[model samples]
Target: MFKENMHTKVGFEMNINKDDVTAPDVIALLQDHLKSMTLCSPPESIHALNTDRLRQPDVTLWSAREDGVLLGCGALKELNSRHGELKSMKTSPQHVRKGVAKRILHHIIEEAKRRGYQRLSLETGSVEAFLPARLLYEKAGFQYCEPFGDYNEDPNSLFMTLNMR
Candidate 1:
């Protein structure tokens, strides 16, 4: 349940559910997320997953909805027994700045902990358009780090990781 605030509706009740990445609305939002990423970084630097790839067994996608309205979504991909990666994370355009992403992020972190992941990592753009995302991760204790797993160094990309201990 979200607190009633200036940005949220009076009876804001958010449900973060494990999604299959097949719903039409979820697909549309993911498309928009990919489109927005293309505008900010080159194709090689873009890491947001498409619907098909997000359905892989190693990945889990969660969507946040309030009163049946989609607010945002995020994904976690297990890298190994002790590691995980933050994949696609996007807030609906109308719901941006309404604490949607933050809540989803918190949910992801808790899930990672529950899964016994020792670390959670992510790759995001390094451009100004990604400032808000970078700040959000930083606020959640994610520290800048080197590329992990199958990634390589790229000027247009920034990698971060949180030590779960």
Candidate 2:
């Protein structure tokens, strides 16, 4: 469960690692992430994965921490030999706007590239609460796209993808 060190704009050294999703802090953060989803979207529209689903064989979760404090987490789920889905991306409430997500997002993109994935996609809420997330993905070069995999056209969901090749 170890990746590499990322130095932030604020000069703090953050560590991104392959996470097991068992640590108390990581579990607590995940609970908050799931609870937040409920506030903005109905159960039917919420696609964020729970802890059990996150541990599935096809998914790889990563955690970002600085000086032993958990800052954020994200996951990549292999949809096929050449495509992947970004899931459960969340930054701790106290760590928002601190570059934690940017670093983790960068790491996921690099890992997808390393895995020879042709594309990386994600589904986020279409509401205002998700504007920042959409902006982050857009800044990373992800573009609006049709839903991939098991997802269908739903007004509540916004799908985006990045071509890795």
Candidate 3:
């Protein structure tokens, strides 16, 4: 629960839960991330399979909140016994640079680890507009790599992975 225009109280409970991933909220977050990606690359650069796809049995959605406002949100898609994909990561424009992304990223990573996933991968952008996102991923221990899952090789996309072990 985030409070806009207010200070965050450290140790305040962040209600991170699965059911918080409402369709409307998740779609809004995806739209926001897509807009951010479009500023740097083509419209297709902001590719996310449909929200219905994320409704799969193996997919997990996590959201962060402080004081009732949405801070950031992300999803983890379990691929196999040891691998998971980072999907739909976004921080509200108002909350950017305020550690909201880091908090959500850490929460997703911990969730993946808790689920016994040994590896986590993500597909971001490869454009100047995405430097900050790339930096954030790197700061969170993600390293560049080739695209995985249904993604194909594209100079427009930057793929990264982290070893949860």
lDDT (CA) per prediction: 0.92, 0.92, 0.75
- Highest TM-score scorer: 2
Clashes per candidate (backbone, < 3 Å): 0, 0, 5
Candidate 1 pairs with clashing backbones = none
Model 3 scores what on Cα lDDT? 0.75
Clashing pairs in 3: 1-65, 1-66, 1-67, 1-68, 2-66
Give the distance in Å from residue 61's predicted Cα in candidate 3 to where it truly belongs.
1.3
Which digits, one per residue and each the tens of the lDDT, describe model 2 over residues 2-109? 233355565788889999899999999999999999999988998999999999999999999889899999999999999999998999999988888888999999
- What are the models' TM-scores? 0.94, 0.95, 0.82
48-110, model 1: which lDDT tens digit per residue? 998999999999999999888999999999999999999899999999987899889989998
Ranking by TM-score: 2, 1, 3
Q: Which ten residues in a row have the lowest lDDT in candidate 1?
A: 1-10
